[model samples]
Each structure stands twice: as structure tokens, then as C-alpha cells.
Target chain A: MNFALTSFRKDLSRWRQDLMQTAIWFAIPLTVGGLITMLMSGDGAQPHGVLLIADQDESFLSVLIAGAYSAGDIGELISVEKTTVEEGTERVNAGEASGLLIIPAGFGDAFLDAEPVTLTLKTNPAQTILPGIITDVTEIVLDAGFYAHQLFGEEINTIQSLVDESNDAAVAAIAVAIQNKIEVVAPQLFPPVINVEIVGPPATDVQVSLALLYLPGIIMMAVMFSSNGLASDFWVERDHGTLRRLVYSPGQLGSFVIGKALAAAVVIAIIGGLTLVLGFLYHGVSWAKFPSSLVWVALSGVALFSWFAALQMLFSNQNTASVISSMLLFPLLMAGGSFFPLAVLPGWIAAIGRLSPNGFVVDKLTSEITEVGAWIIDVNSWLIVAAAAASGLSICAWRLRSGFAQA
Target chain B: MLKVDELTKNYGDLVAVDQISFEAGKGTVFGLLGPNGAGKSTAINCISGLLRPTSGHASVAGHDVVSDGKAARQNLGVVPQELALYEDLPAIENLRYWGKAYGLRGAELDSRVSEVLDTIGLVDRAKDLPKEFSGGMKRRLNFGCGIVHKPPVILLDEPTVGVDPQSRARLFDMVEAARDAGACVLYTTHYMEEAERLCDSLAIIDNGKLIAKGTVNELRAKLSARDVLQLNGTFPLDETRQAVDTLIERDDLDLEVITQEEECVTLTLSRASQHLPDIFAVISNAGGVVTETILRSPNLETLFLLLTGKELRE
Candidate 1:
């Protein structure tokens, strides 16, 4: 018992001091990475807005126009306010209002005589939704104004003139008449809204495809990139003759190698899990089912650590490890859905994703949150990953014990 | 007992150590004397279990270097020609580490370390980094590190190289104390005078061969020359030198002039105790004035020159 403890303590102290720099090396990058992810999570801003308008035409037709435009909840998004035409155009241009309408003098006389009249309407061209909305509301308001004129017969113009001496009843009537004409030509532009309902219980709220599709590839890439420290540590120890000393220590060669692999596993698990938590906290990923999600992630970390150890040992130098890790990393990233949506990726890439460990882990986690995938969690694939890990450990052990450590 | 039996080592076609052997008993100082590349270092390396021999065997305190490497290593302490102290570490820390390597622990290791530091005359500077030390201090620390574990046999490989005369003298004293502590010491050096002054018995190896091995007097007796001869001088006479050289060079005398310096000349006559009358006859006939005459014994330098036919330093 004393012998084992002494040996373990010696190894722990040496390994800790030797790899202190490497830990800081990895931790700084991971922390900065989490910060950057937190800072850049969503699109620029929310897309909803409001438009306010004012109308001063006080005729009964004008009142009818206001009632028509404010006829439904649609106007809740477009409010009317009292103001002059110039003020209204400035407001519309400044984005405070959507549009402005002005009625000429003698508009009541023209409407009573059944004469033509011109109504000036100013539209804001910069707003894609507001201009169209303003046009639609104007047509509705004018159509109602014309209907009110017809219902009042001769008294419509007289009542409008009494309410506002300069009210443009003819312009309002003509605007509604034009909308009525366009109703024959462009009825679909203002089609009635349809209410939607489902026949059964509703499905989940968040789309599984959105998060699961990219996360697997991201995780895999992260695993490969973050495991650089392990490989770097191997090269560092070899250069420093620390590995030689450890190998010469009695009964420690095997355990030392195992300890290296375990250390890599712990580091990868920590950084990978941190990435997941940051994803949840900042990206708003529903990690309510975090327990099982964390399990697959931990397994992914083990598999990655194993692969990295074997591959690093196989590599002759740091440049070789970096190039190989990245080559395998980015391809898995592209396939497993990190950079772009999986739906847009080529079929072959998605097929490759089917074999990717990251894809498997992410798909497993995503399945608990939303049900949009057909990905199967095959036990055989996991077995294959485990077998790969075993083979890697064996190769690393052999190389470390014999090839480089023959002395 | 430390025995090197007919040990041979080769680096490719070059024979670093030819078949050679020697033995050192406990508490004895066995000096390995040689010129540069005369295989002194190679033989010591084999004895210390650092280099394996191509043939023959070496043992430390009866433990075979090859078959019982750990035990053999445990029995021997080696101070290599190059200082092996870690430069960044303090002297005591270096001593402690080596002590641990030798399986010493706790208060035992601490006491041994302190004792070694005191013996090496570095007790005051034990806490200082070796790199900050003078060449002499570093060499002392190197010696301390090697002997801190108290192995049964200690190998000193050119321990005084690049050291000041004062430090070298102090180090020699320390080595003598090591011998007094009951450890067999195998000392190797090119400085013939050092070996002559300190070695209990000496081995003079040349060209990978042991040319001579014995006490200084015994080895000096191998040449056909008396150990020492008297010289009488008067006013630095050339005739006196010529007369002595002539007598010593004659086949019947078998005597040789060893030194002629500053109004006097010294000679080692072959069978001088028997041929003293003949030497006086020549000195008297040369009209040389005899001021003084005295006889003294020969030392290892004369013996080394006789055996190797070259100066030890050369």
C-alpha cells in the first residue's frame, strides 16, 4: 500500500507540474471561446415593429374611413393620430407614421355633383411592410367612405362640410372606388385572414432539427481541436526526458500511460461539457433533459480522448498531429452539421454524419427535446467506438513502451 | 573488495579498454594512472556499472556488475570527470535527490547529506544553487552528491581537474577521509604527482595495457637503476656533470642521470650500492669539487617514465 501510494504521489506531482502550462493553455482558449459564444448567439435583433398615423379629415365619410381602417385587430399594429399632411409625410418619412392623406377644398361639392376629385396620399417607400399596409388600409377606408356617402345620399357631403369645411369627401370616395375596382383586379392582395387549428394534441415547441443538426458536428470539431493539449503533452514529456524517467520507474509504465489517457479524458470532458452548458445558457437550447445529454457527451469525450492519444502517438510531430486532427476534424464538422444546416448538406455528407460519433451523441441528446429525426442509436456503433478506443490504447501503450522508450 | 578481471570494452573498432585487471581492498586507495585516452576513464566506467564490458567482469564489493546491477550500483559511488550536479538545484537538494535514488530516507538521508556537505567543506554554501558556485565549489558539491549515499566503494574520476591548488589539496584530504571511513576508493587521474602523493598502490596503464602495478618503491625498482644517488657540487662545474654522465652511461655502471640543476646533479646508478667506488673514481678524476653528497629514494614519476617511456602529462 505504501509503495503504490508513494509511486502515485510521485507521478501525480511530476505530471501536475509538467502539465501546468498545458492546462492554462487549454483553459484560456476555452474560457475565451465560451465568452465569444455568449456574445454572438442570436440574429441582430427582433423583427416586429409598429407604425402610427394621424388623419384630420372630419367629414362623415372621413369618420367612416377611420372606422374602416380601424375595423379589426390589424389596425392594432397601425394606429391613427391627428396631424397636418406635411407633418404626416414627415412622420411617415421618419418612420413614425406609415403614410399621409390630404383632401382638397370643395371636395364635398365635387362628391355631391358626382364630379372627379384628387386625394393626395404620401407613402413611405423604405418600409416594405408598412407601405403595402398603408395602401390596403387606405383602400378599405375609402371604400367605407364611399359606402357612407351612398347611404347618406345628398346629406353625406353637407354633413362632411359641416364637420370640416375643407374636408375631401370626393377624394375619399374616389380612393374607395379605386379600391373597389382593384377588388376585381387584385383581390388576393387583401384576402381575408384564415384561422388555423390542429386536429390532435400539439407537438413539441422547439424544432429538434435546428439545434441537433449542427451541435454534433460542432462537438466533434471541438473534441478534435481541444485534444491538442494531450498530444502536445506527449511531445513535451518526450522532449524533456520525463517519459523516459517514468518508464524506468518500476511497475509504473502501464499505469503512467493509462494516467495520460485518463487525464486527456478528464480535460476533454470538462471543455466539451462547458461548451454544452454555454450553448444552453446563451443559445437557449432546451437542456431540461440534461442528465442523459451529459451522459452521451461524457462518452463522446472518452472516445475522443482515446482517438487523440492513438493518433498523436502515431504522428511523428506536433505539425503532423495538428494537420491530421484538423483534417479529420473539419470533415466530421462539415458532415455532422456544424457550419451549415444539415438539410442543405449534400446527401453523402449526411450519410457520413450517420457514422460520426458527434452526430450520434448529438442526435441522442436532441431526440429527448424534439422529435424531428429518424436517427437510430445503434449499440453496435457504440461498440465499434469502444473497440477503436481499445485499439488506440494498445497502440499508444506499445509505441510508448517500445518504439520511443527502448532505452 | 572491488575487482576488475580482464575487462575489455570497445567502441566499434576502437578499443577503449584493453584486457586489464586490478583489485582494491576495503579502506585502500587504488590509483589509476594514465595519459589521455590511456583507458583510465573507460575502466572506471566499467567498474561503476555505467558501461558494460565486451569481455571479462567487474564487481563492487563481491556483487557482479552485470548479473547484480542494482546491488552493484548500490555498492559503488562514482564521481564522474564531468560534474553531475543539477545546476538549478541547491547543493543540499542535489545531495538529497541522489540520496533518495540510493534508497536513503528520513533522518538517515538528512544526516548523511549534512555529513557529506561538511566533509566536502561546503556546509556553509549547501543552500546555494550549484550554478552560482565557483568551479571549485561545484566540484565539491559534485563530490558531496556522489558520496552522500555512503556506498561501499567510491570511484573518483579526475576529481581535481580544473580546481585551484587550495581546493585540490582540500579535496585530496576529503578523499583520504573517505578511505578512512572504510570504503575502497578507485581514483583515476592524469596528474602523476597527485597519484604519487595519495595513492596507496598505483596501476600505470598505457595504450590499454597495465604496464606496472604496485607500491611506488616496488614499481620504481623495475628499471635497472638505483632508487636515488648522491651528488656533490662545487661552483657549478660542467666537468662534474660530464664525469657523472660518462660513468652512468657506461655499460658496467648501468646508472643514469636523473636531474642536473643549479650547481648540482642527481643520478640514479644501476647497482649503485655495489658500484659506489666506481662513481667516486670518475667524480674525483674530473677535478670536480664535492661540496655535498646525499642519497634519496626514487618516486612514482621516475617509475612512470621508465614504464611508459613518456611523461604522464605528455
Candidate 2:
């Protein structure tokens, strides 16, 4: 064994002894992944909404239209509440409910008399998807009412007219007329209701894909954090005087850096591998991508650690190095689609994130995680990672040997 | 064997080590004696290849420290003033790490690590981290880490600094053991007793210059058997100078003034115990009262004071 290998073995032993630190580094991103998953309401989650109806008509037609929501599968997503127009308007305006429905005072009579009357829906602008669903249901109800008027307008008008005259005989005669109208139109109006089908179970429900969407970025965040930890170890070595001891040794300081980077790669690959395995099992990542994914992940770890180590060596003061490295980590995590999905982030943020050190790799890993991927794609990514690791670690080694520390 | 010739290091305006030179062969312990800010560390650093000398050069086992750093460093071992062991690692692992660093391998590396653990008396605590060890144990581990590869040339910079008497004794024994193994040891320390007890030959450096160089007895001989004499009382500066003028001029007396204060005066001369009464009579005649009198035989401590006109600890 030579000094480089010696350094590697030493760091490995140190990491083993300080298991809690490694565990925390690995645990943090997973914990963040879980919390963000809950926050984004993934795992087949459905958000419930409130619907307030203000019916001034208090008539049969108006009540029937409002009752339709409670009677259908749409009932699962929305709760129906009856209120006065003033209260309903206040609730919708306050964003306390999804939407408010207002039926005009003469709406029932106008519909029965084959006249036009308005049914107004006031949707909460603050609400996005739920208000739109409510609007769609309302439109369907209106279309059904219009077609019923076209089909049975004469019979309905006779029933309304007969109720005011000699009640028993007129009611019987109107019933027979409605029966005759239904028979005449029955063949042509087979299945009058429009059949709307949901493509899949995701009806306003956030699913596992939403959570998995952030996995690659968050996994990269974990890699960066581990790299940061690895870089700080150099500071410790410098402070403890072991680094000064290395100066007296015959080995090149470059070997020490290479050794430490190797250790970081191992730790990072394990994290990336385990997370990718979970992705493979439940999130549609192919098993065939594992080997390449592992190699890419480990290489990315070395690149990230090397860059962080370069940042550490850039300063003469250890405190400055520490502050700068810590400061660099979170912005990368935030902009790189680790904290929030790139699709949801503002355009400028996503652009900056994609340009960040770790963000491009994150984007590549997540682009088509559900589809089967090549062993590794985009040769430029490999070159970038390789170049970054080489240049950054080379800088660190050069600085270390160039009188940064005196023996 | 290790050799340094005109080794000089400059920090722009400050010369940390200037034109100092010496050589120590196998089985000899050469000591660099100086107080704080004496450039001892700079000189040793240059010799160990940890620092580049501004001009001049050094070599370890015949390899140039500058132009041939790796080869020179391979033959050299450094135990710095600071405890440089990895506190997170067990003592055995620390030994192994440094052993392998010097290019030891396979069975040889294991044997050397085990030997060092036993030699440092950490065999029982081999699996324990340095952080859990006592101050003395950690210091021993520090020493063990340096010599684990058994380099031909070793530099021990203030190895016994801040240690208890027992630990200091253990360190002295370790240095003697390495010397017996035919290693050329270059030890640096300010403690007069350690230099006298452990060093076979040494140099006294101050302000980046070597002031004196010889064996323990040889350097003491520079004092010419002049025992130091001290008198505590009120004495005028001019009167004290006038009082010692006569004896200073006499070659037989071999007298010299070490230091003079308002109420105290120290002087060194041959057989000062025999000349004390006469000295007291002369000071009395000069209107100076000797309230207390003390006399000591010559040693390196006194010689350093004689040569540098300052106390050894100063």
C-alpha cells in the first residue's frame, strides 16, 4: 500500500467510526423526499373541495339541478352546501369554497315555459383544478336541461298549465301526454346522457409519479451534501495537523485527494444505488439501467466532491472555505429541481438550475425515468463530469502542494 | 546519515534560518538547541523536505532534500512539535497509515506497525482511538507514528514538550532506542536538561544563527570552568561595572559579566567559591551591599548565558 491507498483506508476507517455523520447525510435527502412527497400530495392523493349553491328559485327544476352533484361520482371530490346568495358570494370571494352556484328567481318557471333564464356559477380564482371540475359538471347539467326542453317542451308546458286548472282530470291528461311524448322520442333519444370517461385513476389525484419526479434531483442533492461532508474532512485534517504530516511524507498530495474522492464515490454510489433501486421497484426505472446508473452516480459524486474540495482550497482561511461550501449547497439543491420539481419551478429558476453544477445530471437522470434508457446517454454529460472532477481535484492537489499548509 | 549546509529560509524581510550547517552520522543524536523564535523548526523543516530553503540545501542519507525530495523524504521521519496522530483512528491504525505512507508494504508493513505499537507501549490499547488516550499516551503514539517505518534519518521537534516527567523519560528512552538502532536522529528542543541528557553533540542557535556547536562536555568547556556567581543587593550600575573591571581584565580569573540589574548582579568566573569572599570585599568597597550570595558550577545552561549574554530560557 502507498500513501494514497493509506489515505483512503484511513478515511474509510474514520467514516466507519463516525457512522452517524454518514447516516445523517444519507437520511437527510430521503427525509426531504418524504416530506416533499407529502407536501405535494403524491401517492394517489385527492384534494376535497366545497361547492356552495345559492338557489333563489326554491323550485323543483332548480333543486333537481343542484341535487345532481350529490347524486353522482363527482360527489367524491366536492361537498354541496346550501347558502344565501350573499353568504355564497362572500365564501367564494374569500377563497373559502371552490365555487358558488346562483339560480335566478324565475329559473324554474322559465325553463318550464321554454324561456331562457340564467344559472350563474361564481368560481374561486384562487382555486385552479377544483373550480374547473365544478364548471364542467355545471355545463353538463345545463346541456342536459336544454335537450330535455327540446324533447319534452310541449308535455312539460301542458303539465304546468294543467296544475292550475281542474287538478285531477288535467293531471291525468297531462301524464298521458308526457307518456306519449316519451314514447315518440324514446327510439331517437336512446341514452340521452353523455358518457364521459376518465382516462385513468388520476382525477385531480397526485400519484407516485409526482413524488418520483423529484427523486433524481433529490438524490443528486444527497450526493452534493455528501461531497460537502467529504470536503470538510480535509479542513479537519488540516486543523488536526495530519495534513501537515502528509507534507513530510514522500507521496504526492494529489494522491491524498484522489484517495478521499474515491471514498466519497463509494458512499455516494450506495445512496444513489439504493434510491434508484426503489425507483426501479416502484417508480418505473428499468433494472437494466442500474449498472450504468451506478457508474454515473459514482462519477458524479467524485465530480461534486472534487469541486467542493476546490472551493475549500480556494480560501486561505478554513472558516471562509466552510462558509462558502455550505452556502453553495442549498441554492444548488433548490434550483436543481431537488427541493421543487423543475416543471413547477419558475422558468428562470429552472434554467439556472439546469446550468448549476449538479442540475444538468439531475435533469438527465429524470428526463425519462419511466422509459427504458440506454446504459448512459448524452456523452457530453460524461465529459463534463469527468472534466469537473479532474480539474477541481487537480486544483486542490496543486494548492495543497503549493505551500497552502506549512509543516 | 543526514547533512545540512548553509540552509537558509527567508520570509521576504525575515530570515527564519540563515546559513546554518551541520552533519550527524548514523547512530548519533544531533540536537538543535534554541529558545522560542530561534529558527530551529525552519531548519528542521527544510531538512525534512517539508519546506524549501531560500538558498543552500540539505540531504537525508545522501539524497538532496530539494532536487530529490521524494527519495530524501523516504529516508527521513518527522515527529513535529504538534501531536499529529489521527484522533479518530485507533493507535494501531495510525501506525499502519504512516508506515504505509513511507512505502512499507505487505508483511513488512504489518510487522513494523506491530513493532511500533509495542515500542510505544500502546500494544494494550492498540484498538483504542487516540482521543481516548491520556496526554502522555497520545504523545507516545505521535512518536510511534514517525518511527514506524524505521527511517534512517529522523527529526524529533520538541518531542518531550509539555509531557510529564515519566512520559519525558519514556521519550528519552525512545530516542536512545532509535539511536541504538543506528538511525541518525536530529532532535530539537529548548530544555537544557533534555539536550544534555539525550544529545551526543548539538548546536546552539538563536535569531537564525548558530552561536555554539560541540558535544555536551565540549560546549561546557567553552565556559572554561567558570562557575556562575550571583549577588542580591542594591548596586549602582557604574559602581558594579567598576567593581568587576579588575577581575575581568585578569586572565587567571577568567571573569565575565552575565547580567547586571539595579539590585542584582550575576557574574561567571573560575573557582568562584574560592573567590567569593574577595568579590564580596571588593563590592563592599565599591559602596554595594551583598545581602545574598549564590554560586554554581559551569554547565551548558551557564555556557549559553555566557555565550549569548542572556539566560537559557530567555
Residue B48's lDDT in candidate 2: 81
Which pairs clash in model 2? none
Q: Which ranges of candidate 1 are over 4 A from the true structure?
A: A1-407, B86-90, B122-131, B164-167, B222-249, B252-306, B309-314
Instruction: Write model 1 residue lDDT over A108-161, tens digit each, in one string.
Output: 456566678766677777777866776776776666556655655445444445
Per-residue lDDT tens digits for candidate 1, residues B32-87, read 99998899988987776656789999988898887887678778888877766556
Candidate 2 chain B has its poorest 10 consecutive residues by lDDT at B305-314
Please, what are the lDDT tens digits per residue for candidate 2 over residues A100-155?
99998999898987787888999999989999999999999999989988877876
Kindly provide the TM-score obtained by chain B of candidate 2 when compared with the true chain B.
0.95
Report the C-alpha lDDT of model 2 over B189-293, residue by residue, as the tens digit: 999889999999999999999998989989988887789887899988898789889768878778888888878888988888888878888888888888998
How many clashing residue pairs appear in each of the predictions shown?
Answer: 3, 0
DockQ of 2: 0.62
